[model samples]
Target: MLQIRKILLRGAGLEDALVQFYSGANVLAGESDTGKSFLLECINFILGAEKLTLVDEAKPYTHLAVEFVNSNDETITLVRPTSGGKVAAYHVPIADISGSGQSIAPTRKGKSKGPDVTSVLLPFAGIKEARLRRNVEGETQRFTIRTIESLFLVDEVAVIDQQSPVTGKATFGDTAQKRALSYILTGVDDESVAAGEKNEIVKARLKAKLELVNEMLQPLNERFASPGELTVLTDDTELDTLIGSLTGELENLATTRDAIQERSQEATRNILKADSQLLGIRELLSRYRLLDERYTSDLDRLDFISEGSFYFDALQEVPCPVCDQIMAPGHSHGPDSTALPIRESAVAEAAKIHAHRTDLAAAIRDLEVRLGSVEGEKHTIDTELKSLNTELSRTLAPRLEFTTERLEQLVNRHTEREATRVERERWQELVKLQNDINSSLAESGTPKQIWAGIPPKELGEFCAEIQAVLSEWKWKGTPHVEFDEKTFDITVDGKPRQSHGKGVRAVLYAALVIGLLRYAAKNHRPHPGLIVIDSPLTSYKKKKNQTVKGENGQIDAGVEAAFWKSLAKTSKDIQVIVIENKEPPTEMAAEVHYQWFAGEEAKADERAGFIPTKSAPAN
Candidate 1:
């Protein structure tokens, strides 16, 4: 429960401005354009905000002091450079300022060394070092005090239009937003709930393997009549049954393949033999044809000789040489006695040549018939081999090959399934360990509902309190305000806050912030124990001679009076500072602490604005 006790802004050239607050409600009311909003800016700057802003008059200020009380009732003064530099903290009072103290540099969270604003203030607020998930799947980051600041401070613009009180102008993502709320409501962080050994690395590896297993199972499922049957096949016995069936099918296929291979080999050998024999017969036929041609030529010559011999025998006489006398039968010019023997031998030689020509013609005809028979036998063998090869390709070979491939696929799937089984067992072991850790947490005095965070029942009760606050303020048209779970915005009379005008939106936003404070204080939730609101009642102002209407219709005349009266009663336990343009009602003025800034037109000694003039400063 860290609560601001006091804040001071001092400068060398400008007058010292001071504001002191109590545990209850404090109102600072004044005219337009006064430095009322500037106080909120200074408070945030002293905290760990990255940017700082100041009004024109307060620009001369170079240092700010924030004194806050921790849960142990110890006051720590945080002194920081107003122009944005390193911050120094003191356990002593801000009044006893020294030249040095513990230095805590200003930097973005998660980028600094040991001692910073969060490390200093978180112990004061009774929160342990913790982390919040940035997203469902993203990494977790350490929680900073800046996350808790939204509940403690509400600036002018935020008091008018923003929806969730936990949300800041800068995005902290949705999971972080919820985690921050849960941390404040219940003193639990992501580290407390997250199982230790079941780290992200293990979970990620398991997830990848599970995805691979599921992908492989999809195709296997399609092979079955009902794909859903695969769900029951995780056991080893079930897998082995399928494996055995596939093996039997593959064995049958192997037998048929072996037979076809043997027949193809035998046919191939016969084709080679026929080809070799045909080559030898072609060589013999070529030599025989050449020999028969020579024989036929010899026979033709012999026939001509035989015909010449017959003519020679017919011409038995010869003519005289000089006196034109007829020659005797043996007319010889020389060697007259050898003529008769030569003529007789010529007749016998012609007869023998004719017989030899007849025998050569018969042998040529027999050789032609033998060559034709050998060519026909080669053609028959070639056709038989072609038929055998076509049968093997078209039927038996394809059937055998398909069965073998299918059997291989089934065997590989079984091996993969066994590997998947091991991974699944490891994953289950991790899950069991995680569950045991959670159970131990519950047994060790953590609330059963803490693991799941603040339940809907608690949220509904909180919303009921907000509804009661709105009703007490006399809101228009039976205003049924409830927290929407999805968008984390308020639904006014069953309509979202965004559907309302700015004035109405302002009033609803104020209720939500105040309601959180009231609920946290009453329920003993982990809160900063302080809420500072600026311009909470925008609808009550008299703008351009017309009062701004909110909610159902024009705001009732007594709404402002009721609003402050409710705060006065409800804010008694916590410190709440409200800044607005309109003053509090006359009847309820004494019930609340009030300040009025009359602007620069007043006498020099009187309180004209937040910054004092030359006269004096208020205590």
Candidate 2:
């Protein structure tokens, strides 16, 4: 563990100032614009961070030194020119860094040499300038200081990020972040595993392959677990059962479909027969009307014949117009006159005609009765045909369509079963590979659990510690907070830390940083064992026109105080440095070392700032 003892700022033009820090909680409390954040920047510069923004007052300072004890309990002093250039290291005491030192330029990556800070500092933490295998393809990357710097310093931007403390920013890739975290948790660099025996190297290779496979499988598993997707996974037996059920359903639907088709055909045939029959009936009715008209005419003719027969009987004599002489009364020989038939013969002919008329009327009534019967039958058939058409349109169509859709669903289910089968096989192969590696390690008498990348149990424990700390801080959420593996962040009541306001984001960020430190120390994991945070409690200060009100936006007084109190308690095992504008709470005053910078006041010691203010005229 790397623990800072003192940070000193000195230059030819400016007065020398040294700030000493304890292993426990340290508070740099003061008003804004007083160079409190400048100390973090100085620490970063001393630790080989790229560039330093030179504030106007800091421009006068030319050199800065950070004295810290390495993991080996050896005190080392890191000295760098404040103008931001190469670093100089000294093996001597912190008080003697000004005397003799070896100068070394910081390497961006790879093996450090001479006075490079990584070369001297990493050695104490049991790391050499190591080449880490970045991918399963055997590509390598050299460890650098930038990879591990976040483990110690949580800058102003990082303090309010509401994400993982180890996450890389715009310039740093996530792979580097992962490497940094792995280094801290395992304490095993590429150098440690590179020197393994042949069999051990083979086992390591197998383990690496297994890890890669797992990494590939993680998202796939999440996809399987995603919402609005099928939940059941089918094995061969289950698939067979499902297929059997689907087949049975399809067969039944097919039978019903066939029945419907047959019924429709039957109805169509019946409708055609009915239409043909109706047409025949209409033709028969038309013929019946014609016959009725003929019968009526015959009846009228017969009645006229019967009436004329009586008139003929009245003409008993005939006259000859040519001679103007009447012939015998019983005999008529002229064309205009006829002799009357005997009275009996006339009566017989009239009776015959009257009988024919009665017969014709009866025939007309019989034709009318037949026409009425045919029309009634046609009406009944038309009603039946209409009903059959309605059934086809309203009932059978939708049923058939629904059945077709169900068939499609079954086909999709079968496809999914095949895909599930493939996924399962791959998963099983990966499991076997892991088991073989574990067995090999056991046979070789090597500890299987030794420094294997952060296990779920450890992450769970870390999450529990965070929850505990938040509880102590009186955080406004359920006690069921957990770590989000995908995002490498924390969630409160199932909401991500980013969903919170800026103030809560800062608080959660502090909790995560401090919680990880405590977790590392408790587990005896490799870590720098120091957390330097800037403005973690900024939300607690009331600002002008403060309107935002949410977990991350607003400040809770009790929770804020509790945050410091929890830090005070955890500081016993890990060193924590907090930079805040607000004064330390009375409850935590005894536990934390307070350095108050009151740049607004006139006094020198109590009211001056991190950088010395201009001297006033003696009055």
Candidate 3:
């Protein structure tokens, strides 16, 4: 088992950033963008990555050093340049690296006239002179440390990607990944497999077929970035159901919008009706007012006639001379002309006009009341129309728009599934062609199987180890884990690991790595004995006002705690380094090597982050 002890990064005129690890379990928890990922990259670089990923915070740093103890308990420290170059291995610790150390090339192909890092580290992990078959022709290549790195060093992206935890991202590397795992589990290498020779014609035909298959598979592989996509293409029931559900929701939203629109239209119509009646009432009131004025004028004229006749009748006869006489007091002014009778008739006419005026005034008052009531009704209708319009625009319309968008997404997914189905068929054809090539090669010569599958008893034991790991972590389901040889991945409860959500995938991937370590330790199998995981608990952390649920439809309240406790109880023979953003449970603080990057300037014993913001105090 290779246990990491300490890592240091320093440059001239800059503060040295240092992190130390312990034997059992180590955790580096911090905020994001604070060089936690950079630290992982630095480790990979030291292990044998051709290039170190450059980050802005690490720009000033030029050298990195990692100290670890191999399975033999021999302390070894390796120092390499961050700018890329050969690595210097010191049989002693990092503090003594300046004395005497072996200079090893960073890569296997480097012309540095020194041993490569792979050759040096392989023996340290109890693996020496291992080889893996590169192709179906049984041609072998040296299995370097990089071949097994993914199993133990899981980064953030790899932890949640839908690819097999063993198979990694590259489709072409699937065979290599499987062979690497087999080598670890079974203590076997592919060097004993014999390479086959083919005649020129056979080789030419095989080459053509291989090229054709690769040409067809390239686009399919690129289109389906992950195996999960191909899995999705196999069944359309879930997608179809989702599409149906979205369609139903969209229809329901449309119905609601239509209903609101209908109500709005009705309110508008009622408003218009009330407005028309109000207008009619107003016009009628105007005409009635005019008639009332005419009645008043008639009454005034009648009054004047009545008063003038009364005064004339009251006049006494003065002179009887010719026409000047006052008609001799009711004598021959006209036929029986008495001013009293005229006055009485005029007064009666005035009273009739007055009564008509009173009736007209009452009618005007009634019309005014009706006009007010109609106006009130119009106002009420207008208010209702405004409210309906608001609801249609603000509530129903937005909801309808959202549902339409969701339905469109489902439709697009359905279309993508169709395209994937075609690609899947093409992939099948490619597989058949490859199998035919393999058959032709087999018929030509007897080639030893490069990698016989893992023994069933061993595989069963490995699966049980994984189940135990998950059980210890308080995994949501009754985990029945099986290593799927067909997919080169694990299945939990008969479901492929990729089928679960990303959080579950991450947790399951973590379990696989840890379980492998535990299994190797228990069975005395060869393993690196060191595991570094990043962000394994990110999706398990509860955010503000949110309750996180796992795959079993239960709140994951205890999963994170269980994860920490399990790691804390990991065997002392193995070293587990977990990089996370959330804090661990307080109870397990004493059990694990807790390295906290406070993500701020240090106060007292706290750290700022993986990248120091200031120089360390002189001792």
Per-model C-alpha RMSD: 30.3, 26.3, 23.7
lDDT of 1 by residue, 127-207 (tens): 567788665444577777676666678876665544566665536475677677766555566764443233445445445
The better candidate by TM-score, 2 or 3, is 3
List per-prediction Cα lDDT, in the order shown: 0.67, 0.68, 0.79
Error of 3 at 92 (Å): 0.8
Mind giving the per-residue lDDT tens digits that candidate 2 earns over 279-301?
76567657756765765676576
What is the per-residue lDDT of model 3 for residues 504-542, given as tens digits with 9 covering 90 to 100?
788888999999989888887768888999988775444
Q: Which pairs, if any, clash in model 1?
A: none
Ranking by lDDT: 3, 2, 1
Among all windows of ten consecutive residues in candidate 3, which has the lowest summed lDDT? Answer: 546-555
Off by over 4 Å in 2: 71-73, 108-115, 126-138, 162-164, 170-172, 188-454, 540-552, 571-573, 602-605, 615-619
What lDDT score is found at residue 288 in candidate 2?
A: 55
Instruction: Give candidate 2's whole-model lDDT.
Output: 0.68
RMSD of 3: 23.7
